[model samples]
Target: MTDLLIRPAHHHDHDAIWSILEPILRAGEAYALPRDWDRERALAYWFAPAHHVFVAEDAGAVRGSYTIRANQLGPGDHVANGAYATHSEARGRGIARAMGLHSFETARSLGFAAMQFNLVVATNSHAVALWTSLGLREIGRLPGVFRHPRYGPVDALVMHRSL
Candidate 1:
């Protein structure tokens, strides 16, 4: 982690970003994105104008990526909504945690007072544990809301934490 660098993403970082995102998304265990989405559709969603995207670079390679944005509009804009993804081969190396901690600082600096994940698929244990350890608490649970590819219908957590 000594060489890990968390920085704002640039246009040139698209391929690296997608490399980390495609597999996880296709696996359909965590995020709700479509499995058959092409690179262009995926990249477009990641680079949406409202999303503030960042990448975790280590040894000159992008190991992971995250996004921070308003959880909602108007009265709800003060709370941050974020997402993170680590490259398939880079799992268990603490990339997600590093990006998560960095997101706290980044979110607070951006004037967000809190962060909330509306749907943390309960089956993604690594993400659930990581988010919990990072101070997010499961404020609510939607039973059988996420149709996990392998697990059928499963619960989802609504996690929140003050920034």
Candidate 2:
């Protein structure tokens, strides 16, 4: 794999970041986002005020991106939640794993005591396996919750790890 740099996303990186996010959102398989989400709205969601976004770059090209934010409001604020997306051409390159690790450290630095992935699409075995390997365990399962575009009503897992 090439040298990958994980850094805080800048305002100018919007286009490159969107290139990685667009396909993932449109796929409607991994995330619970709208399939027909437009670019403007999608960008707004990814860069929402509550999220701290980051990107993985290789040779100055954005390869992946992620967002870190509080999992809930008020009393549940100590736990962090994150979402990741890798560019189609950059899969299998360990970009997601690197981003996950970085996100954990970032979460800790931001005063988060734990990290929770509230909606890990069950059919996304790669991600499930990755999170498991990273020491996150399935804490809960929502049966037939995710209406996966291809897999129909599939389960969604809640994976969590104490920081």
Candidate 3:
């Protein structure tokens, strides 16, 4: 990855962003999203105005992407929420960790007091471990909250951390 940079995503980056998002969405392994979600809907959901979307570029190509925004409205808004997706080819290269740390800093700068991942599928141990390593604690768990394409219904863990 030459000159990898994290920056606000532009309209033209949608294709690359979608390319990264589709596999994640289709897998329905780590996220709570529906596996049957179409590209158009996923695009709108990710690029909505209420969230801040970013892309990690290397050598002028998109390698990873993340979306950050308030977890809730009004009082709950002090806690931020984020979702990340990396190109399959870019895995195990520190892209996710770098994006996670970057999102933490970006959230704090926006005045958020903490960050919360509302629904991290328990079956995704790698993500659970990563979030834990990032200092997010598993505050709660929702049983049978996520429908994994292969694993059927699975528990979702709520991970939170003060920024």
Candidate 4:
């Protein structure tokens, strides 16, 4: 594994961040995002004012990105939610794992009591295994909830772990 530097994303990282996110969004395999979403809207959603965005840089290139925010409003705000994306070429290099660990620590520092992934596409087996290995348990499952591009409607799991 390379020395991955995880840091808060800045305005100048827009292009680099999008480079890592676009392919994943287009694939429509891991996330529930609209496949036809344009770059501007995608960037806006990922870098929204309320989100704490960060990027994993390896050898000066952004290999992955993730965003952390309150899972919901009011009473449910104590739980944090997050999304992650790694460049296709960066897979199997531990970028996602590094980012997940960073998000866990960041979430705790932000005062969240726990972290939850509202929708983890069941078809994304690698992510399921990774999150599980990281100590997040499958708290709930919404059967046939995600419309995967390749595989018809698939189940989505709600994973949670104390921060």
Candidate 5:
């Protein structure tokens, strides 16, 4: 874990970032994105002007990535929102946790007062556990909001934490 470097993403990282994103999206389990989304569309969302994108590199190879952005505009922008992804081969290595911690700091540094995840899939136990461990509390639950590929219609959690 000490070997991991979390830094702002560069233009050259599009391919690496897409590589990490494809499988996750294709699986249609963790995130709500379309399974057939092309690289251009995925990269556009990841690198959107409002998103502060980053990548985690270990031994000079990109292994994970995340994006921090305002949860909304105007009055709500004070609260930040984030999304994360890791290389399939790099799971269980603490990359997501490390990235989550870094994201809080990065969001706070960007003047956000808090962080919120609007639609965390309830079936994703790993993410729910990590967010709780990181001090985010479940503020609300939307029943059957996420249609998990295997689990059918599953609940979603709205989680938040003050930065």
Candidate 6:
């Protein structure tokens, strides 16, 4: 098993985070983010100072990353929101799982009573199963919520778990 270390992201880790996120975005799978989004915009959207983001580093290189924040403002702020991406080469090594667990812990520590994934793409069965295995439930589905480049329009699942 890989010895992964999860930690807050520093300014230097932006490129490493991009290395994992760019392909996932370009592939237009899983996430609802725009396919043609550029690196600069993606960096600003995912790694900006307003959000709490982390990187998973193994053997001195970043192989994955995740971002967590309040799901909404005011009354809904008690719920947490998160997103994760791992390098394709790192698949099946439990990198995403580790990041997910780490994010859960961080969210709880930050006083969020629950965590919610607002838009999990239905075509990405791997992620759906992973979230299920982690005890999150599919509470709702938004039909044709994501426009996948290869699969065309697909449903998006909204998942939630109590912290």
lDDT of 3 by residue, 102-124 (tens): 99999999999999999998998
Worst 10 residues of 4 by lDDT: 16-25
Itemize residue pairs with steric clashes in candidate 2. Answer: none
Query: What is residue 36's positional error in candidate 3, in angstroms?
Result: 2.3
Candidate 6: segments with Cα more than 4 A from true spot: none
How does model 6 score by TM-score?
A: 0.97
Location of the lowest summed lDDT over 10 successive residues in candidate 2: 18-27
Task: Report how far residue 52 has shifted in candidate 6, in Å.
Answer: 0.6
Which pairs clash in the backbone of model 6?
A: none
Ten residues in sequence with the least summed lDDT for candidate 3: 27-36
- Candidate 2 regions off by >4 Å? none
In candidate 4, position 150 carries an lDDT of: 84
How many residue pairs clash per model?
Answer: 0, 0, 0, 0, 0, 0
- Measured with C-alpha atoms, the lDDT of residue 42 in candidate 2 is 90
Task: Give the per-residue lDDT digits (tens) of candidate 5, residues 105-152.
Answer: 999999999999998999899999999999999999999988888989
Judging by lDDT, tell me the better candidate of 1 and 3: 1
Ranking by lDDT: 5, 2, 1, 4, 6, 3
RMSD of each: 0.8, 0.7, 1.1, 0.8, 0.8, 0.9
Superposed model 4: Cα runs more than 4 Å off: none
lDDT of 6 by residue, 1-163 (tens): 3578999998899888888889999898877788779889999999766589999988888999999999999999999999999999988999999999999999999999999999999999999999999999999999998988888889999999999
lDDT for each candidate structure: 0.94, 0.94, 0.91, 0.93, 0.95, 0.91
Which candidate, 2 or 4, has the higher lDDT? Answer: 2
Q: What is the lDDT of candidate 3?
A: 0.91
Between prediction 1 and prediction 6, the one with superior lDDT is 1
Per-prediction TM-score to the true structure, in the order listed: 0.98, 0.98, 0.95, 0.98, 0.98, 0.97
